[model samples]
Structures are given as structure tokens and as C-alpha cells.
Target: MTSTGAPPDWTTVDIAVPRRSDRLPGISMAGFRQRVPSPVDITMVAHPAVTLLIDLGEGDGIVYDTPGRHERGSVVIGLMPGELRAGGRVGDCLQIRLEPDVAAAALGASPELSGTIASFSDVWGRDAARVEDRLRAAASWDERFTIAADILGRRLDARSPVDPEVAHVWRQTLTSRGRARVDSLAGEVGWSRKRLWSRFGSQLGTSPKRAARLVRFDHAAHLLAAGHAAARVAAESGYVDQSHLHREVKAFTGLTPSAVAVAPWLAIDDIAWPASSPTRNPGTDSPRHRARELGAGGCHERQTAVRDHC
Candidate 1:
């Protein structure tokens, strides 16, 4: 693996991604290693997928912080854990993002994990340590990715799948970038609106409307990261206006669009998760070109008031 430059103050971060043929449907994996080990901190941006963070380093691999809780080591981060921060002396780590449908089967309890973070052992039971040992002992990143895919593929095949209708709704919501109306989705699926809503929540751990908003916000965040102005991003992302965009961004990340533009978490996304669709807002540059324009670190102190998007 080659080194990718981080912000001015930090050492380079080496990123490893799976080969296209090795990638699994509904799952994305990337391995990260620090060139010069040191304490690191970053505020995580909200995304549509359920995240599995496998800590493979010794000592305090990673520490997570939410409003009133703190957790260390490998963890499962469910959809939209607002204002979450991950930091500490990370060495080598594997991050896997699971589509909600895949997560339902692979995790077996995704509905219970919504909007929260759980210990890896809590979700995988005694096998968590065993899995970590196997990953840590792997001869290379490619080996680790293969081992991870095998473990997840077996679990996914063993469990019941999500409702076809619910899965369809989710796919449509994302394709539309959160502009798909709930009633229209229900109609297309031939299910009553209430039925769709109930099933979606029970199976996906989040309502359809909330999922759409999250997806929409994620798209806008990437646009902002790519150097698009807030007004333009809002217009492209289906927001009522720039103010609407600001509120949603603040709600999800506790930061304004301008702040999110330089968020370190998003800087490595194009490198770590290369399969994401390129940002193609009209008249705007693609995110891949501006991905590393981000500043060093993330929001360390929690800000209470909303700031100007600027």
C-alpha cells in the first residue's frame, strides 16, 4: 500500500481497498494504517450505511465518544450516530460499511442498533475476539479483507433477508437522493403507507423519511467537501433553500456546511471508499478532485450554536 498525505500536522495514512472482484454486494471494506503512530482524532460524518469498525492494533486502538458515553476498541456504529468522534492511537484498522438490508441479515439485530454504537463483542459474542485475532495475524491487507468477507458472507447467507418491498424502497430513496415521497414509494410497492413505514422502521432501524434525509445530507456534504457553495449544494440536493440545508447539516454533524467542507473525516472518503458515486453537481468540480482540500483534525470542542455557512 502507498501512503496518502494527511493534514499538515499528522503523518501519512496508508489506505488499502479491496479489488473490484473481491468486493461484495451491499458491503464496502477499507483498511487504514498510520505511517507514524500517534494519537489521532476525527469527527465522523453521518452516512447511510451501518459501519463495522474492526480495531486491529494494540493498546487503545480506537475510542469513540457520544453525548454521554465513551467506548474503546472495536465497535459497531449504527446509522446516524450524531456528533460522534473517533480518536486515539489507531494502528491498523478495517472499516466495513453495510447496506441496511445486508446489515439486517449480517447483524441479525440492526433494528436494535439504530442511532447507537455497540461493542463488537456485544454484537458478535465470543467470536469477536477470535475474529480480531485472525485479522491481526493476517499476512497482508488483502488477506484481512478476504477473511472479513468470508465471515460476513457466511452470516449473511445464514440469516433471513429483509423484506423485498422495504429493500426496494431504500434503493429508490437513494437513487432519488432522498427526494422520493413516502406515499409514492408505498404505492409503487403496493403496500399501504402505514405498512411501508412500519416495516421499514422495524427492519431497517430507521424510518424511510429519516433515511432519505440522511442520504440527502450525505450527498450535500460531499458536494460541500468538493468545494461547492451551500446555496448550490442545497439546490442540487433537493433542499427547500440554503437555510434548510444548514439546519439538516447541523442536525446530523453539529457543524455548518462551511465547517463540514473542511472536515477531515470526509477527506479520506474518496480514497477509503472509492466506489461512491462522484459528485456531479452542475457547474461544480467533482469531489475526487477536491477531496484532500480539507484541513487537519475535526471539531474537537462541541459548539452549541449554529454558525454561518459562509
Candidate 2:
């Protein structure tokens, strides 16, 4: 797939969108290489404003570190820090879902919940040690996720309920409009601008407008991956112009639209299609649709320069 060579002895199969569950709407699955015996370094990156993570797979654990060093294997159950970044090796890891509440909780005021999930060695308490032990003892990816979910569920349940109206407004603004006017969203949520900011800051670690932008970026990435043009995707995703789209794509993904389109790794052929959903197919574009497509040209040349230099 994608000319990566018969799949590495251990390959990661990631599914960006997952079927809805009673608790979470979306899921991301990461299938680790079974043959790799030692931890293989990997990175987990997210769009700005989204901070929660779910560990559905295997290996020692995930480590959240700063510029130079990092903590080793640790299972992070609650909200991740605002600047939390993941780096570690994955082995037999399955799936993880970042729930809204977990994300919100991490954004709330708490010393233990500030930034990324690090190893037990990085933290200072007995609780962290216990968690480390449990994670290491876990046998499978499912077991790890189960423990993580339980810990997060407890932490979330202890927090005060968020205003349903505000949450509703946010959901609507994100899913339908792809952007939110802070003043307008505040009005719909029956809160003052200050109050709305406080709520969003404490719950999302970012403002509503910022969160909306991240959501919009996610949608845009999907469209680009589906072979849509930059101009069309920009309009559909609520950007002002193709240049704006390009800027945002570069900032979030470190790649331009055309580069992402032509990258062998981003090709549809590189992924394993889930079989349960008959409605979903990776490369089922009609001949007519393919005919109207513009191949990645200029952007490809620029990306080639970056790759060659690296």
C-alpha cells in the first residue's frame, strides 16, 4: 500500500473516523507492528485546540515530554495539558477515542492536569507509580483502554455539569457551520462574552473560535485527502480564500494541500479499508469525478525540495 513496501514487519494502520458509540462520536484506531519487538519511536500530533487522547493499543505506554527530554511509559487517564505532545513507540496498540468531557477536564484548573502525559518516572506521587505498574501489567490494548476509560470517567463524573445550552451551541457551530462567531455563540448559549470565555478557557483550554477553526481544519484535511481542489475546499470549509486555506494547512499539518495530495503516504491506497461499513470505500471515485480532477503539480515540486533536503 502506498509503495511503503509490503507493509513493515510492523505497520501502523490508522483509521481517522470511527463508528459512533453511545459515549463517543468519533474514534481513531492505530494498529502497531506485531513483529517489532522493541519500542519504535512514533509521534502523536493533533490540530491546535484539541487536547484529549485515548490510548486503545499496546506497548509500554505513551510519554508526553517537553523540548529536550521526556517521561517514559505512562497511562494518562484525564485531560492532557494544553501543550501536551506524544512521543513513544507503539506495539499492538488498537484504538483510542478522545471524549469531549476528558478534553474539557484537562483544560480545567488542576496541577496534575497541566501538560502532556509523561511516564511515572517523570511524576512525583505514589498514585503515578501505581498507575505505571497497572499499565505495564496490562496484557492487551483493550485492557489498557478499559483502564484509561475508567479513570477518565471517574474524573469527569466528579466535575460540575457544563451548561447544556453552551455545549449544544458549540456542537451546532462546529458540525454545521465549520466556524463560530464568539459573540453569536455566546448569545445562543445565554452567556456574556466574558462568561463564555471563562467557560471555554476552563473547559477547552482554548476559545470557542479557536476550537471551531480546528474542527474546520479537520474537515478540510478530509476533503483534500479525497482529492478536492484547494479553492473548492477552502470555500466549503469556510476559509476566506485559497491562500488562507494554504496558510492554515501549512500551519497545522506542515504540508501544503498539493503536497498532502501527492504524498504516497497520504494516498488512499496506503490505508486498509474497514470492512464493516458497506457505504465506505477508499477509492471509489467515479470516472466523471476523476476526469475533473487536477493533479498535484506545483505543490509537489516544492514538497520534493523539502524531502530532498531532509
Candidate 3:
């Protein structure tokens, strides 16, 4: 993977995606094995999901800067995580993208994780090493996937789920690809605006408006990466104009729309999140198709004055 300026050459990367039956709701899994690797430094950009990377690497394979630095065997990347990267050497990693609702249960707490990056041990404690050991010891990538799925699935069942109303609002925001308005969602969900805001932030970790913007920006960023014009992306992704889109992009991630479109971090998204959407698959050609998958996670709705139409 190319970092420190030059874009990565995609041909050398080998990414393994799980079969449909192996998939878990609200989670995306991919086993990444990079060939012809080099020291890599690139922006992680901002996305709507909580990220968990289990280093299948022999040593510390990644380093995260800015947003509370920490390094270890595996890392937990909170929602809207800013720039970060894998180090100069290539290694194996089981990258899992957990939707906010699912993450609240699986990772222990959403408020504890939002906009932060830390070692998996910071949250999972010893379980981090135990799971990593099983993954590493497994004979095949598929077996590793199974191990991870079991752990996460167990956690999902173990912890209390988010409130039904809050979960509904989140699902609506995602289904609308961040275009859903807060007021509209609240009204639909029959909750007072203030109550909805309080519960959403407390349970999901980010305010409702912020979550939608992150999801919207994520959708737009992927579209831009797919070679769609910024103007076109803005119009279709629900922005008032290209400049509105530009501001949000720069706000969430320190990069302009053009740069984010070709971000090295997103270069491997297809292999990493193949089932992020229904039609998308690893190494696919359509950016538009992949963009759709970016917000494929679930949530419901309610209405409020705080809108994320930017």
C-alpha cells in the first residue's frame, strides 16, 4: 500500500470476503492480506461506523495519530475517526466495521468510543488477545471469520440493545443515506425533539444531526471516489450545492472532496466491506454502487429542527 503521498497500486492487494451466511447484521468483515507492502501512512477519513481492526500481523502493524494516540495488537476506531494508518510493513488484519447500534453492545459503550482511536484492549481487555489468538490459530480466513462472528454475535446478544425509538431513528437516517431530517424523524417516531436528541446521543454516542452528516458525507465521499463529479455528487447526495458538500467533507475530514474521492484509506473498502450493500462486491468497478453500501447499516426515525442537509 502506498502512503506518504503516492496512491496505492490496488492489484497487489488480496482481500477475502465472507459468504452471505457468514455475515452478521450491523457488522462488516474482511480479511486483508497485502502483498508487495511498504510502510503506509494515509488518512483514515471519517465514516459513520465504529471500526475494529484485529491485527493478524506478526507485530504492531498500525499506528494512529491525533485523536488520542495509542498502539497495540489490535485497534478500535470510533465513529468519524480522523486520519490514521497502517505502518510501513504489510501484515494480516481482520477489519470489522460495526454499525453504531451494534457497536454500543459489542464494544461496551458508544459514548466511550465516539471520535476516538485506541487499542482493542482498551475496551475488550483480555478478550482482545483471546480472540486474536483464536483468529491467528485458525487454519483458514473463513475460520477466523467464524471465530470473530461468534465473539461479536455473543456480545450482541449479551448487551442491552439501544432503545427501540432511538434504533428506529438511526435506521431511518441510514436508509435515507443521511438525507433524513431530524424533525421529520422525531415526528415520525412520536418523540419530543429534545428527548430524541438526548437519547440518541447518550445511547449511540453522537448527536442525531452529527450522525446523519457523517453518514451523508460517507455516502458522498464514496461517490466522489467512484469518479462522480463533485457537482453531480452534491446534487444527488442531497447537498444544497457542491460547496456545501465541500464544507462538510473538510469539516469531518481535513480533506477536500477531490482528495477524499481518491483517498488511499477507501481504496480497499470494496474488499473490506463487500456486503456493505446488496449489489456491491469486492474489487467492483462502480463507485456509485459502492457508495450505496457505505450507509447500509440500520436505524429508525423521528423529527426535529436540527437538519443535516449540508
Highest TM-score against the true fold, candidate: 1
* Cα-lDDT of candidate 1: 0.77
Q: What residue pairs clash in candidate 2, if any at all?
A: 10-33, 56-95, 57-93, 57-94, 58-93, 81-114, 81-115
Q: Among these predicted structures, which one has the highest lDDT?
A: 1
Q: TM-score for every candidate vs. truth?
A: 0.87, 0.62, 0.85
Local distance difference test, each candidate: 0.77, 0.46, 0.70
Give per-residue lDDT, candidate 3, residue 40.
52
Cα lDDT tens digits for candidate 2, 107-151:
233224333443333332356556545644766444554564555
TM-score of 2: 0.62
Q: What ranking of all candidate models by lDDT puts the best one first?
A: 1, 3, 2
Using lDDT as the yardstick, the better of models 1 and 3 is: 1
Query: How close to the true structure is residue 62 of candidate 3, measured as C-alpha lDDT?
Result: 64
User: Which tens-of-lDDT digit does each residue in 39-157 have in candidate 3?
Assistant: 65455666678888888877556666754575755788888656655455557778888889888888776788887787888888777778888998987777777788888888888
Off by over 4 Å in 3: 1-11, 274-310
Give lDDT for model 3. 0.70
Give the per-residue lDDT digits (tens) of candidate 1, residues 1-310: 1111223354556667775656788999888777677676666756899999999998867888888878899999888777677778879898899989889989987898898888999988889999999999998787888889899989988889999999999999988989999999999999999999999999999999999998898888888866789999999999999999999988887778887776555556755764453464343233223323222222111101111121
Model 1 misplacement above 4 A: 1-8, 280-310
